[model samples]
Structures are given as structure tokens and as C-alpha cells.
Target: MDTWRQIIADDEKSWVLFEHGTCVVLTTPGDDLAAQAVSVLRDSGPVHPGTPAADFGTVPLETTPGWVITSHHPDVLTYVSPEEIAQDGDNTPLAAGLYGRSKRDQDAHSLTVIHVEDNRR
Candidate 1:
């Protein structure tokens, strides 16, 4: 299994599952589902009839293109523009788009400029 595509614990005590380039947030409070998902993911062999725990929550069999699991709380990635910047005290457009680390990161203070494509239709 690809490391990036594997289900991992979100920095904010939730489960983060990735399929394709989209991320899925399984809102299993108290990390219950996240733990189970991680166990299943780390186990050897394919996911089958009896692989997942009987009480385990639903596992998506396929990913919907251009779909996002919405949440008010930011995960590992967040988007921002020049208008949201807080340095110059002036509201000028400083960049086309500034990609910055999510505040949740351990050392969260970096920005990179890159072309962003809107996959949503």
C-alpha cells in the first residue's frame, strides 16, 4: 500500500484517510475509529470479509472524484490568500496564492507559491 494513501491519525486526534488526491475525515470521536482504521490498514494482506473488526465503521470501497469530507476544523492543509495575510498592515494583493503550512504542524511557519488547480466542478 502506498504510504500517502494509507489511513493515518490526523494531527488533531482524528483519522485521515486518503484516496487518489482527496482526503477523507472520519469523525470518530475519541479516536476509536481512527485506531481501528489504522490497525486494518497496517495489517498484511487484502481487506476482506473478516478483516475489519465486526464493530468497525464503514470503510469506503471507492473514492468519489472531486469529493471532499467537510469539516470546520482545519486538518493538515489549509488555503490562504494575500488578503488573509497579516504582515504589511496594508490590504494589497501580495500573491496569486500563498500555500502555507497548517497551524497544526509542529513548526508551522512557511509559505510556498505554486499553481493551484480547481478540481471541483
Candidate 2:
């Protein structure tokens, strides 16, 4: 979350409206051009993830009704049904876009989706 990393000299609380939607940032977007930037950020990272897990290997375990980890490769995919979707209502997270900041690279992959909410803070 570069929004949290940047050191701004001056700022005021103004909404950084995400008209585009939400993004599910994956572990990586896969681009050789981003290798250098990734390495740099990886080396410089003291960035607090805020997530409960301390590291990737120790990702907090949560049991959802639809989940399984393979012994050979440990892959995961969840299945959601129409009933679940209806229950989720407007709170469900779904992809909305795929964008690359630099033409040469995509830093990471993310699932983006547009949502409606009152940001009147």
C-alpha cells in the first residue's frame, strides 16, 4: 500500500476516491521488468502489513466451508454459489479491472471491482 508508505511533506484529509473499485492484490503480477523494483522494495520493506500473519509461510489459517490445500503443491481455490452471492449482497468482493502503471511492467496482480458506499467521513 504505497499510499501508506509515501512520506508527504504536507497533506490534508481528502478522500482518495476509488471510483474504479476494490482490488485483490495478489502475491505477484509476473513481469521480468518489475524484478528490479520488486527486489528494491523487498529489500527496503519494513512496511507493516497490518495483517495478523508475520510472514507468507505463516499466513493465518481460517477454515471456510470450501477450501483445500494439496499436499504436493498446496494450491487453493474457493467456490461461491448463487445463494452465497445473494447473501453477500453488496458486500461481496469481485474483480473490476486490470491496469499497469508502467507500460513495461505490472508490479502486482489485483482483482478490482466497483462498489457503492458513503465515504462521508
Candidate 3:
């Protein structure tokens, strides 16, 4: 039997599960990565099947092409722009599209950018 890596905890309200090889980020619902689908805990604090919190932003790591994950809260944000991810690198794009206007693109096939409607979108 193959072992699966699962993230669960109370302080850890949100989580991003990366595929073993693809580095794809999978989320629960509104998470779109997995179609808002996850094993939800019934009542316990941190049950075997944890409940999925509402996901917001999507951030694509500039370091790798296929490495994409959900952007956590501002304090918990994970993905960083190429400029921030690295500095003084030849591969850095002259026109790094990280800002909203630039619209940094990511590995579309391997990743999922989900934005649930909140009276916005």
C-alpha cells in the first residue's frame, strides 16, 4: 500500500497538498485544485479526515515551472515572485509579470487557480 501525505491541525487551518512528482498544489473547495473536495472531519478538533477551510488566492512559485500552490493568508503567503524568489539570476525575466497588471502565469496544466465568489469575481 502506498502512503499518502495528509496535512491536519487546528492552528493549521489551511493546507496545500503537492502531488508526489508533479508538484501540483491541490486544495479543497473553492480550492478548485481538487474542486473544493476534501475529507472533512465531523466534530473532533483535528479528525482523521479534516475539514477544508475556504481558500482564497493562488500563487505560482517562480522557481519551478510545474510547482504551483495556493497563496495562503498574507501572513501565510507561500509563493514569491521571481524577483523575490531569487535575485541576480540570469533566468529572471526582464518583464517579470508578478503584479496584477503583469499577471504572472504558471503551469496551467499542473496547477489550479481557484477563486470562490465573495460578492466579487
Candidate 4:
């Protein structure tokens, strides 16, 4: 098993790429980033393990201060926050389990918790 350190290495800006080229770029060094990525994946849908790769879509990349995520697979659903959607307008149709109400509710709850925690810090 590759430790997070081994996967992240010494790069300040690193990404953990998935089998289908989905990736999470880490812009800071912290275990929290890994947890956040996993949370996002889990909240989105079922996360298959062991079948593909132990690290597939789960590993955290070394990052600095600002990190970004990118995915290439057509099956990958892009999530935009309500605030962002309001500001920029939703460009994609909500269908095929994308932007479903349940997922949105979960995301909203998670975002609220994160917002509270961040404010406390």
C-alpha cells in the first residue's frame, strides 16, 4: 500500500488521478484535504474499492493553498454550488442523476457544516 506521503511526494501542487482521468488537485498539505475529497466522492455516489485500484479516486494529492478538481469522464457529474449557479447561471441541464434533489440536499448540509466550522476557525 502506498502511503499518502509516497503518493503525494514533495510536489507542492499534485493531483490524484483516477482510472477515467478524474483528478483532485491538492494545493495544500493537510490530511483534511484528503478527507474532504473522500467526503465529496461518497456524497456523490457509491465509491467502488479494490476492483479498480486501491488508490483510485481516493488518494489525496500534495497541494499548497488553493486546490482545484477536474474530471474527464462523461459519467462524472459536475456539481456547482447554489451561489455559484446563481451568479454564473447553470449551463448544464440537471438530468441523469446530475443535480438530483437528494444529492443537493446532502451537499447543502455538508456545505453548511463546513461553513460553520470555517467560521469558527
lDDT (0 to 1) per candidate: 0.27, 0.22, 0.26, 0.32
TM-score of each: 0.19, 0.17, 0.23, 0.24
Candidate 1: segments with Cα more than 4 A from true spot: 1-24, 27-75, 86-99, 102-121
Question: What TM-score would candidate 1 get against the native?
Answer: 0.19
Q: For all the candidates, what are their Cα RMSDs to the real structure?
A: 17.6, 15.0, 14.4, 15.8
Query: Candidate 2 vs candidate 3: which has greater TM-score?
Result: 3
Query: Could you tell me the lDDT of residue 92 within candidate 1?
Result: 29
Across residues 2-102, which tens digit of lDDT does each residue of candidate 3 receive? 11112112222333322221122222224332332122211111112222222324433433531222322222222324544345453333222222111
Residues 1-121 of candidate 2 have per-residue lDDT tens digits of: 2321121112331112122211122233334323432343233222234431112221211333211111111211122223333553532223100011110012122221122121123
lDDT of 3: 0.26
* Model 1 Cα shift for residue 39 (angstroms): 13
Clashing pairs in 2: 21-113, 96-112
Error in Å for residue 89 of model 4? 31
lDDT of 4 by residue, 1-121 (tens): 1232243454454434332222244444255654554455444433334422111121123432211122222222223233433444552333212333334334323432221011111
Winner of 2 and 4 under TM-score: 4
With a 3 Å backbone cut-off (N, CA, C), the pairs that clash in candidate 3 are: 28-36, 29-36
| Top-lDDT candidate index | 4
The TM-score leader among the candidates is 4
- Report residue 57 deviation for candidate 4 (angstroms): 20
